[model samples]
Target: MLIATWNVNSVKQRLEHVLRFLDEARPDVLCLQELKATDEAVPALEIEAKGYNLAVHGQKAFNGVAILSRFPLSDIRRGLPGDPEDIQSRYIEALVSAPSGRVARVASIYLPNGNPTGTDKYSYKLRWMERLAGHAAGLLRLEEPLVLAGDYNVIPDARDVSNPEAWVEDALFRPETRSAFRRLLGLGLTEAVRACDDKPGLYTFWDYQAGAWQKNKGIRIDHLLLSPQAADRLTGTEIHRHTRSWDKPSDHVPVSVTLDI
Candidate 1:
């Protein structure tokens, strides 16, 4: 089955691009981040018309996540556990049965950007990572086919970014942030892209400013962390870099992995 993750920036603004992608990629399951709309505002009707089930956790004008699957989605969960007061619509998970008759658990997450480090936002970002780590540890115990995919808003390493020095002060590439990401991987999760492709300079996001895309100045922030079961079936991975050049495209592009399961 083909599973993909994309941070659409704003689902409403990029609805056309999204529709086009859904047609072109034809993934069995697609995890979306940054919907920037409420549940009522999401274009569920149009999506359903494409023969997919929709599950969304949305917020107004900000963070949101969703999952679109060709198969029926069950046990839908709307928020990340461990933080009762944390209301950001950054996570949503569901169970999807692939054509191969394998049931996999998947989640779409839009991690906080936490810009201009050394502030409350940065602290919150760290705390959120901790909570995610704890949750991931528990999920690992399930020993099922699990895919944690989305816009992680993290630069895992200098090799993942266009210029390490340029992002040193940014929250996304901070040392602490990278460490947190490493901790997540330490929980027995396999980063699908890295596992399938080790080549450097492969990126998933580019800024709109400073001719980032044109200059190929980008970073690999979007990711798919697969459980051991899913990792064993990993067949291929792709970064839809061409999408960045499309009309009114989002700064981020789709990252996908094909699994035998």
Candidate 2:
């Protein structure tokens, strides 16, 4: 099974890019983040026409996520379980079975991007990560093939960013933020791309400002994390870098994993 993730920025505006991707990549499943639109606002028919069943969790003009799969989806989860007051449409999960009857639980995540250092927004980001950690710990016990994919908005390490010095004061690169991310991996979840390739320039996102893309100033914020069972079946990982060059394309590109399910 081939599963992929991309932060389309806005599904409505990126409909053409999304459709083109579905046709070209043909991944069995795709987890999308940063919809920036309501579920009703998403161009569902256009995507469904490409043979995908979608589970979307969206809010108005803000965070949103979706899971599109070729196979039937069950046990669809629309929101993260740890917080009831938290209403951001940032997480969604579903279970899909490969033709061989193997099932994998997949999630689309748009982790908070806490900008500035000492504010509620920053605090919320940490709290959200903690909630995710608590929830993820529970999922790990299922012992099934689970894939948590999305735009984590985390620059994992100095190697992940083109200019570490430039991001030192940024919330995404803060020590606390990085530590929370490591906690997830410490739970035995294997980062699919890193497991296959450790090359430094393997970035998944580039900013549109200040000639970042032209200078190849990018970061590996987007990720596909696999549970032990899923990691075992992993065959390869790909970062569709060329997608960034497409007309009015998303800052982030599609990252995929091919597994021998």
Candidate 3:
């Protein structure tokens, strides 16, 4: 089975790109971030028409997420637990039952992009990270295979981003954010892409401004972190850079990991 994660930026604007990637990559499951669309506007029927099950958690115009899978998705849940006041549609999880009827939990998350990191948004980002750590702890106890994949927004290390210096003041690069990520990963989870790839220059997101994609300046903020059961079955990983080359493409590309469980 192939599991992939992509930050589509805006599903409404990049619906074509999503369809194209689906046809090309044919991942068994695809997690999306930054949908920027309301649930009613998610084009679910169009996606289902393409032979996939769909689930979306979206708000008005920002920080939405969704999951598309060739297999059936059950026990769908929207938003991360632990905060009733948290209204952002940034986290969605479901149980994907494959052809063999074996089910695995998968989550598509979009961590906050707390830019100019000295305000309430930054604080919210930190708090959100804490909530995620707590949520991950619960998943760890499930014993079933769990795959948490998404645009974490926090760069794990200098190797994950092209220029460590340029992002010094960025929220995504803050030591606190990275430490939060480490704490989450400390829940006995493994980053599938990092586990399979040995090189550093492989990035998933490039800024549209400053000709970042053209200049090949990018960051691997989007990721697939797997539980022990899921990681043990990892077969291959690919960063589909060609998707970023498409016309009016999203700023981020898709990263896929194949598993042979």
Candidate 4:
């Protein structure tokens, strides 16, 4: 199965780009983040016409997630567990049954981008990571094919960013944030891109300002984390860097992985 993840920035604004990608890439499943729209606002009919089922967890003007799959989606769940009052539409999961009778559990995640360090937002980001770690630990026990894919808003290492010193004070590359990511991996999850290719300069996102994309100043913040079952079947991985140069493209591009399962 070919599964992909993309932070569209705003689904409405990037609908055309997304449609073009869907038609060309033809991934079996796509996990979307940063819809920046409510469920009613999403172009559901347009997407449905493409032969994909939609599972959306959306918000008004920020932080939304969705899962689009060619296969039937079952047991759809919205929102990350462990924080009742946390209402950000950052997570959505579903079980997709492929035509070959293979089942895979997948989730779209838009992890917090805690900017302006030493503030409440940074604290919340860390707490959210902890909650995610706890939830991931439980999911690991299921021992099924599981994929957590989306914009993690995290630069896992100095190698992931264009300039290590430039991001030292930024939340995305903070030591604590990287540690949290490491803890998630410690739960027995395999980062798909790194597993397939450990080479440097494999970035997934670039800022619109300061000629970031023009200069190839990018970072690998988006990811697809696979469980043992899914990792075992991992066949290939790709970063659709070309998408960044498209018309009205999002700052982030699509990251994908193929699995035999």
Report the Cα RMSD per candidate. Answer: 0.8, 0.7, 1.0, 0.6
- Of candidate 3, the 10-residue stretch with the lowest lDDT total is 252-261
Per-prediction TM-score to the true structure, in the order listed: 0.99, 0.99, 0.98, 0.99
Query: Which of the numbered candidates is closest to the native, going by highest lDDT?
Result: 4
Q: State the lDDT of candidate 1 residue by residue for 98-179, as single tens digits.
A: 7667799999989988886989999988898998899888888989999999998899988999888999999999989999
Q: 158-216 in candidate 2: lDDT tens per residue?
A: 98999999999899999999999999899989999889998798799999899999999
Q: Report the lDDT of model 4 for residue 101.
A: 93
- lDDT (Cα, tens digit) per residue for candidate 4, span 1-261: 999999999999999998998999999999999999999999999999999999999999999999999999999989999999999999999999999898999999999999988999999899999998998888889999999999998999888988989999999999999999999999999999999898889999999999999999999999999999999999999999999999989999999999997
lDDT of each: 0.94, 0.93, 0.90, 0.95
Scanning candidate 4 in windows of ten residues, the lowest lDDT window is 131-140
- In terms of TM-score, how similar is model 4 to the real structure? 0.99
RMSD of 3: 1.0
**Model 2: worst 10 consecutive residues (lDDT sum):** 193-202
